[model samples]
Target: MIGRYIWEISELRRSHHGLTLNELNERWERSSLYDGREIIRKTWYSHREQIASQLGIIIECDKRTNRYYIAYEDTIGRPDIQNWLLNSFAVGNMLMQGKDLKGRISYERIPSGYDYLTDIIEAMRENRIISISYQSYWKDEPSEFELMPYALKVFKQRWYLVGANVAFEGIRIYGLDRIKNIEITQQKFKMPKSFDVEELFEPYYGVSLVDGEVEKVRIKVYDNQAKYFRSLKLHESQEEIKTTPEYSIFEYHIKPTFEFEQELLSHGESVEVLEPAYLRERIKKRLEWSLEHYK
Candidate 1:
């Protein structure tokens, strides 16, 4: 019930320019989730506080207009934490309302790793170390190690942990799904003041890091595929360098990592690597190998 209220209030405030207390209550009463009574002033204030504290969203009232509006509308975090939380709850609310439509509405199932999220997040919050027995796809056996949990990221429906291996020199990323077991340690460590997760992963696509420099990569996306690229960029550094009726040339300053190569290959022949001879050659060789399988 509380989740529904939060989602309703957040959605209402987001859609409108501003709303007065009476105006908000009126809309709430009209909502399908509305109970018998209207939201009293005290309850509304409590909800506002909960929303701000729990979701990092603030509902502020305009002193002059006497209207309430959501502050920090456009400044959501890089990972879009606010939207992610709200959207997740919104989906839950929808599921509750439309339980009969379960078969009709499909969702991409996240394979594994969500079970470890809470523990990892707790470790990250306290700046504590985590010991995990991890199974790597490349290795035959599981390896145990202690890691200083720094951040968690999701890509392609899989959760990944970015942390420092206490016994190793550089930072490492481990897929949560690959973790066989995990435990939070009593020992704590200081998170480096200079460490920024976004900055660390900015030059690469996905969580996979490669032994290469950030190079200027350009790709020509042909026909309708260019529209998809424009709507949802492949990378933050992506920019449309040139455009014509037939195709659009997009540029990025990123490492041509293995994950990135796979993403380009997923687009099939719609995308062609135009710059960086090495990356183009690599892609060409990959396509040749793929073709050989068909032959």
Candidate 2:
């Protein structure tokens, strides 16, 4: 299993060079391994040789240059290699576009209730409502919800159900795993007027609703954490302004939702609320209240 994972990492590194040895080792360590042993550096190097031999490509190394790259025109004209590279690149791009890049978690099993998912997707296309017995994590309650299914979204190895609630008469997002039972109803639903998925999720970081009202909120992040946010954009509405040598400011025009607040708080001391007195006070109060637990 370790050998296979090493081969996969080597393949990924070959496609995108400039991966350091430490980075490769850290990625392997983060993997879900049955045996609690570190993958030795020598093992990865040996597996690279095996992979090159199996693929009929010579592995070249430059110790002085400290570079690793695939540099051969042997099968450049082959359609099979071209198609393989295309599919690999497309998968990589999709993962990069997703929100859970840092977690880097992976699942290696076929989903069980795919038929049910397929039926719901088809019902959504047919403008139908679904009566679902959903188990919500927030309330831990298995309640029935008549959802006007709009679209299905997969994020971070999990599926999401996005639709309008028949009972609440508003939009809602549900996780597929939390659903206990689902049945398509005869009653149909018309989607909200001019509902665009891209426009809907533009202001928020996750799959959440964004009302028309926008708040100009300022957040201060440490230089190191700010660098991370610079490369990986959290929201499209985020704009950066340098504040000082130790910290920088990010401005966002977003609806202040519970999920958005959780995201900001996740950075902890690495980030702080700067503007919108109401938001700053909220964060400050939460910090003070949370301090009670530590004491």
Candidate 3:
């Protein structure tokens, strides 16, 4: 509690003498007993020496006005401590929302699982293949598979492990949530030196990768759906060619995968296939099949 008080006083000094004792007391009474009026003055006076000795933060109370302020600006400038103080509020908010955000209990959630992930990161760094009990949507069974975990990425709300299987197979993406267990093996493999994570996903939207030849695709958007496409970018490869009053035309130089088609279909009639006649026919067939469900 004393540590938190000193930290808060230091923060107040950074923000230019925030609140008077009465105002701070009002704010504290709403959140915790630490903010109570009876003990606050006594607590500050007694804790000041201890705070200065332990944390190097000197708390000062003005003689005439009796307002409190932190006097140690020099100590607050440390980079490591500054970074911790900056992110501490955000961490506290996520952990505890009911009480005062700062006074919440500190818990090391990720530190508990650090050993496994650290080993995995080290294996990736060392160009080693890991054997893990991998499970996914395609297979109902859990089996041992050797994977070269190249990039670990968190997208949406889940983590994805992207790499190739030891069978010299194509690049595969695995959801970390579904990974039952992992063990870093002694066997080392070469991560493709040619691969760049940013460039790998440039043409594709979301997690899906385009393995085949890239193709140029043109689509026309109509109605308010054009507004949706205007604000939201589908792919980095997309280029705006022309626009009519009622429609907007966009060309994406990317591989036409199942994922790309699904995205277009999601917007329905508001979006149309323009230049590629083959893609138009495919969309028509899918829409026809979709309409049959209602019939």
Candidate 4:
């Protein structure tokens, strides 16, 4: 409820008029929120205001209208701030519910499974380069890589760090789970002011940015599989190319990396790569390889 309250206050600040208790209650009544607490009391409002103030969300009550208005600069734009508020709200809500979260929800994500998150984030925030000992599945042993931490992204329930590796003099992606140890460097580096993470990764699907040519990948999903693909888009660049009774063709303008192929193959025999001859052959070879294993 606190998260919702923070969100509500931030949103209400966009308007000239503030939100009154009656208006707020109307919203709460329509949704499952706090025990429907009457926040009209001065003390209740003051207490919440204090918490919001700490987060840089200034709140003021108008004497004439008897309503609450968000007065401070917006803190909602910052992901770090939002994350803190979300954690605070979730913990507060769980306490209010007086129930353990066992089976209540399945996060199914292990982003927090690693211990170096704080260290990496701190390095990124401070514009400090970091050295990490990483072991990749494809590699025989752990290797040391000095990376300028740029941004972190989550793909398929795993956390990945995207940055420039000073050691290799190239940009690379590292899986947090594979990270053995991280050392924050004393030498500071300048992150390009024009660096845009989204643009850097626009050509790739998922976290794997293969040092290969980008392609317009087309997949032909047969029958029921097409519906599932439509609901859960294969990629942001996914587009319906053509549909026929036998199959429906969808296209994604992306880097058809190993991860992308794995995702397609995971859908079993329902999907077929059609546009690129290489991807099609790759998939065929994989299926043949699977048969050989069984034989």
- Using lDDT as the measure, which candidate wins? 1
Q: Compared with the true structure, what per-residue lDDT tens digits does model 2 show for residues 36-152?
A: 655466875776677555543444556775644444545544444544544554465445444355668574774444546876977877899899998777776799878888876
Off by over 4 Å in 2: 1-116, 138-141, 154-158, 210-212
State the lDDT of candidate 3 residue by residue for 188-262, as single tens digits. 887787876667776676678766777789999986677788787788777778888888899998777776889
**CA RMSD of each candidate after superposition:** 2.6, 11.8, 9.8, 5.6
Clash pairs, model 4 backbone: none
Per-residue lDDT of candidate 1, residues 10-117 (tens digit): 555466678888888787786566777887889888888887776677788889988887775644454466667667666766666566666888777766788899
- Model 4 C-alpha lDDT per residue in residues 1-295, reported as the tens digit of each score: 3555554554354457887768766665654444656555675567566667555566677989988775545465455555555555555544444444456654444644358888987898899999889998999999986889998877775778989989677678888999999999998999999887777888877887677766888888998889898899878888988988888999998988788889999998899888699889999999999999998
- Candidate number with the higher TM-score (3 or 4): 4
Q: List the residue pairs that clash in candidate 1.
A: none
Give the C-alpha miss distance for residue 166 in model 4, angstroms. 2.2
TM-score of 4: 0.71
TM-score of 1: 0.88
TM-scores of the models, in the order given: 0.88, 0.59, 0.60, 0.71
**What is the lDDT, from 0 to 100, of the residue 88 in candidate 4?**
51
Determine which window of 10 residues in candidate 4 has minimal summed lDDT.
92-101
lDDT of each: 0.84, 0.69, 0.70, 0.75
lDDT of 4 at 14: 40
- Backbone clashes in each candidate structure, one number apiece? 0, 0, 0, 0
Alpha carbon lDDT at 173, candidate 2: 90
lDDT value, candidate 3, whole model = 0.70
Give the worst 10-residue stretch by lDDT in candidate 2: 1-10
